[model samples]
Target: MSSPRLWLVGCGNMGGAMLRQWVASGVVAPDRIDIVNRGDRDFPGGVRQARDLPDGDLPDMVMLAMKPQQIDDIAARYGERLAGVPVLISILAGVEEAALAKRFRTGAIVRAMPNLPVGIGKGVVGLYSESADAAARDQVAALMTPLGLVEWIDDDALFNVLTAVAGSGPAFLYRFIDALAAAGATLGLPADQAERLAVATVQGSALLAAAADVSPAILADRVASPGGSTREGLNILDREDALKTLLVETIRASVRRNAEMAAAARQSAVGLGRITLFPFVLSLSHRPSSPRTGTRRTALRQAQGERQGGSSSRNRTKRLSWCRNGANSDCLEGAAMVPLYP
Candidate 1:
């Protein structure tokens, strides 16, 4: 298939890696790609690199590879020029499609989470797009196929989990390799030899797991003879599912961090008034017969009295009180008056 006219915004480590892989794999021709960055950097030969967007017609697709925090500024600066681009693929971690939609007017906005390994055509790309039609999605999948495992996420919420797994997973594996090497060195092997052995062992195991029809758990069992040293080591990792538990916590931490980053991006976008909030009901439940109801009732009465007295400070305090009294009529009244921020 012929290459799409692609423009990469902010070609950094991850972006540059993908660009190189695409050109080398023939998924994209270097001559058909353009990269925009503030400063010059090494890029694949025949690809255009510029300090700003190129003149004339927009490309078939524009990929946002800049820092997540730069979303607002980039939108403010280039939104007009980028309006109606066929596709806007973002590699910015934690920045969602909703956030991008608020900024750029495009046919499709795809949130792609590609790990560091993608540079070598061995990475995993997790994609989530709500606006992209079937053809646009297929185009994205085709563009990512040369890079590595490409999985389309059905739910936007799961994107962070995917980021935690594949995006931050490589670093976790590297650390595990380092720990293995350190353990080997402590057991009397030369440090360099131990490091080499650890790396090779991990690489071979991963390749085998990838090729194996059975699960990695089955493969692990295959390697552990009933009375073998491998079984002894396996026992330690299997006890209380220690390795599994540790990895769960590790991935959870990463997922949390991704969520935090997403929240920050959304907050920033809202703070800048670049995004609009749709009116939605926030259901809050409370038992009417609860002992606290009387206290809440008294609080509501006080707030109403204060508002009637025309005290601005007291009015604000009343609104806050009503918000805290979930399910109470006062809360409903407060909900009517309170403006929800996006």
Candidate 2:
């Protein structure tokens, strides 16, 4: 089958990662993809990049990699142009298919949650779709095949749970690696040497676990043999299921936050108007800088103009109030949005 012609909206970290892998794997040709991002980014295969969508027929697929908060704005700007795209895939965490359908007209809407490792083709992509038929699902699966293991989640709630696990799993693993290295250093090993050893140990262990036929629990038992050093350590971690409990709590917290963001994304002007200042803080901190205007202030002003003039005028007063409150220098200088979540 011919490679699907694609349009990628918002080519930031995650989008860039997926694009590189697609070109490398020959799953999608460079010339067949178009990227619309706020600013130019270096990408493999010299794929075309522009601030606006290309003029002509819509591509075979349109992937939304932008912020969840920007959904309404994106729809306002390009919904008409993308009215009949065969598939609309979103990597915006916490945003649902129903939310996408409400804003944009498309043949099918698919939610894809891909992790950072997808850049190296070792990541996990959890997909969930209610409207896509077998043919569309197969097409999406084929496109995502090169990135990593593609899982189709049967339940949307479970898909959110998977997002907490596989989607946000890497950062948690990184924390574990750091803590392991710190523990090693505390035990009198040289800091740098301990870090190197810790990293290598974890890397090798992960590879082994991946190759093993048995479950991780069984593998742990196999490594622990009666009263060895590994067993002593395992005893500490397994005591009252300390490690498992901590991880469960961690994932639960993540799941809760994902739900909050999903709830926020699902809100319309009325719901948005009722939200507290925290959401404004998120918007102010995470809003992208415009290519036309280099500063956040100008970009925000542009957004204010758009929001004031855009379809929903009901929340104009409330939104403007929040915008004014968030215009402080401290908030404007905050870090850019992490592509992983809202």
Candidate 3:
């Protein structure tokens, strides 16, 4: 009669949004979440928050929602405990399923990339998992269903592209809104009023496009009157496929950076002789009580120490990161021999 237990680590923006949706839609009960975050951000009412890991035992599943940069801290502190978890889902960008599996030995590991819209039910979520069974994948999908449209990629390499489109796409849309509003202001409307009108137009148009059976290109024809203003605007956007061209590069840049981070995470994972020791020298004793500095720093110092102290250990920590992002959920396994990124 009870919802399955789920432990969430690092519920800031994306994680926090998932928690909000899960509880609001009644897909998961509030009591099921045991959130371990650094500082208190907002969470759905009645969801649990803790300064540290729960004492008794691990939950059946762990959904890691921290930024990709925070993966090292997670792996250092929680990797050993994660060995037996049935499923592990990561929403961090640039991090890969293999890297996650190496860090946390879950029976199945999934990398999930979701955009900010997930706070509302209209968001988009992309999933990549090497789960051995259908049941395991289904279990993960059911939880994400309430948040928004759920998509799984066969090529993990495409995740970088998905991240740009879905994950960073919202920001891009917001920017376009700002551009439209600014252009409207140039025509003498007050900036505040222009902003409101621009946002409303985009929202309504999006809804209209969604409901219409015809493609957006066809819908545009219905809007453009003979020699009318809408046609003029469409001509400008259509010239050189301006919007399409800009978006191609926009996604390309995002995917390129994701690859860079992946390389950094991988380089650190292996205990290669290249690892260097950078010990943490805090002036006073850094205890775990102050979850902010204490817990995180403790984990980082430990990961760094272990990396520096190893010979072959330096290069043995393998990692998974998004390749040039696209629709492909393609994964690059057996990257052991792949040259480490600088």
Error of 3 at 337 (Å): 29
Ranking by lDDT: 2, 1, 3
Weakest 10 consecutive residues, lDDT, candidate 2? 328-337
Q: What is the TM-score of each predicted model, taking all chains together?
A: 0.79, 0.81, 0.77
Q: What is the C-alpha RMSD of each candidate to the true structure, in Å?
A: 11.1, 10.1, 11.9
On TM-score, the stronger of 2 and 3 is 2
Go through the candidates in order and give each one's C-alpha lDDT.
0.76, 0.76, 0.68
Off by over 4 Å in 1: 270-342
State candidate 2's TM-score.
0.81
Question: Candidate 1: lDDT of 231?
Answer: 100
Error of 2 at 153 (Å): 0.2
Cα lDDT tens digits for candidate 1, 186-266: 999999999999999999999999999999999999999999999999999999888977776566545544543554454
lDDT of 2 by residue, 1-342 (tens): 898999998989888889999999999999999999888889876589999999999899999998776777888999999999999999988777877898889999999999999999998999999999999999999999999999999977666678889999999999999999999999999999989998999899988999999998999899998979999999999998889777775665456445445544556733332233333445544442222322323323433443454443334344445445643222222312333263
As for candidate 2, its clashing pairs are none
Candidate 2: segments with Cα more than 4 A from true spot: 269-276, 279-342
